[model samples]
Target: MSIKNRLIAMNFFQFFVWGAWLITIANFWFGTKQWEGTQFGLVFGTMGIASLFMPTLTGILADRWINAEKLYGILHILYALVLFYLPQIETPGNFIYVMLLAMCFYMPTIALSNSISYTALKNSSDSDVVKDFPPIRVWGTVGFIAAMWLTNLSGNKATAYQFYIAGIAAILLGLYAFTLPKCKPQHTKAEKSSFAESLGLEAFKLFGTYKMALFFIFSMFLGGALQLTNAYGDVFLDEFKNVPEYADSFVVKYSTIIMSISQVSETLFILAIPFFLKRFGIKQVMLISMVAWVLRFGLFAYGNPTDGLWMIITSCIVYGMAFDFFNISGSLFVETSTNAKIRSSAQGLFMMMTNGFGAVLGSFTSGWAIEKYFTHDGERDWHNIWLSFAAYSLVIAIAFAVLFKHKHNPNDVANVSH
Candidate 1:
């Protein structure tokens, strides 16, 4: 295959492994297993918990010792093994332990895949990586959408079979990873460093700067909002199945397909990012994202599959802006703000705060809130649940606008293109 094809294949399989189960797993827990909400939160919390340390540790090893592709392969193989065991667990508590092990192996590979791709593209003499890479990366979103469709069509969206599907794809990708171009380690013994420094604790030094600290702190707060929708959106829609008038609606019956619209929007929005960041500085772009989040949850608060189809659709559309804007722009911000030496580790730290700490807090807290205030007679009080989320997002948006003080540097925007 050509290099472009290779990258496309890599992107496709990378997300194919995830798409098989990520959105649908809530259904597997709540619908199939009839597990408690808090237990479900624990299951998702494993991703956040693992994100705290696993990615950084793997990044260090990949940087200093193993080829990125080899490490990627090894992790996926291990992830596949763990996933194969997930379906056998009879209780949510035991499943949490198994899923934690799986996520430890799985989450790091997301960063590793990026590393391998950059290395491979740089080595390919014929490729213009900067211009070509985004297109390739978009295919990963396409793969995610495909998996959602498959899960919905196959009726596996609400069953443990989703894990089997993910495991199979992961195993296939693990084998395929061996054939990718080698990404050799860059560090030497002379460069061996302290554990703290290696993990990018240096970025914490930025916290002393008022603006930088506010940015990272708000990033944490917004990150808390990020996973909230993904963790609950499908469940929110699926909840409507109890309503006699809308229970049979295509959306409620096929919630995975409805949710896949968010991924579709994600793909388009990611491509638009370069233009947006260049046109509107980071602050405005991020502010736009916060506003989008308000709408995202607010719409969900009022929408139903029957009378409010447009609102539901609009919420999914806003999701693209809400998600891609923050995540991609935040990454570019990290790239621009930090020094080159610790850039990789700094990015890892950025992810740790958002995906790690923020996600854990969101999952557990949202679960408790839902179990307490949103569940009555086993039916979700979605109206109140969504309104509460909207209120939380509004507060974050207002605070972010008032605080995060970055002067819009037109020159910085121009420099990003180079």
Candidate 2:
């Protein structure tokens, strides 16, 4: 296979591992295991906990000691092992611990995958990393959607088989990673060196800048917005099964498949980033994303699988903008703003904020808020829950618009494509 094809496959299996279980895991938790809400929230927070350190630690290893592909392969294999063991655990505490281990192995690989891809693409004689990589990355979402469809169609949406599916895909990708192009450590003997620098801690200096510090803070806040839907969206649809008329609806039967539409939208929105970034600049593009988040939650506040199905579908569609606008554009912003020496670490820092701290904050707080304010008589008030979330996003968007200050430079936007 050609280099692009190889990278595409890598990206595909990369997310396929995640898609198999992420959306449907709530079913396995709340539906199959009948776990408590607070614990379930902690379960999702595992990604945050893992992201808190593993990405930076691995980034250090990839930047200094190990080949990025080798490290990526090792983590995937470890992740597969943990995932395979997950079904045997009967308690929520054990499940959380095991899943946390799995995430420790899994989360860092996200950043590593990007590093490997960027390196391989940059090494290709005729390739442009910026222009070519997004197209390749879109397949990762395709892989995610494919896995979601597979789980939903096979009647494994609420079973341990979801973890098995993810495990199998992760192992396959682990082996496949070994065949990818090398991404050797960039650190050299000639460069000034210290223990902290060697460990990629220098990237923390970005926090000293008012712009980067505020950007990361907002990234955390938005990161909280992300998994709210992922954790509850499918369950939200599944709950409609309690209503007589909606009981037989396609959404109740195929909630995972319906949720896959968000990933489908991601593939398209990822392609539009370059154009949007060029025209509106990062600040405006991100503002658009925050606003989209408000709409995403607001629409969900009133949507149903029947008469309000359009609202649900539209919310799913808006998710692409809400998600990609911040994630992709934010990564690009980090890339453009940071020095090359600390780029990998900076990416890790960004992941730490959104996926790490943001995830923990979102998971715990949402769980608490839902249990405290949104639940009554053993039923969740999803309408008010979604409205509350929408209000949260609106507040963040307004604050961001007033606080973040960056002027668009045409040359900077143009440079991304080159």
* C-alpha local distance difference test of each model: 0.81, 0.90
Off by over 4 Å in 2: none
**What residue runs in model 1 are displaced by over 4 Å at the alpha carbon?**
122-130, 191-211, 339-341, 410-418
Lowest lDDT 10-residue stretch of candidate 2: 409-418
Which residue pairs collide in model 2, if any?
Answer: none
Per-residue CA lDDT of model 1 for 67-143, tens digit only, reads: 87888898999999998899999987889998999999988887677666666766788765435556778798899
Backbone Cα, N, C clashes tallied per candidate: 0, 0
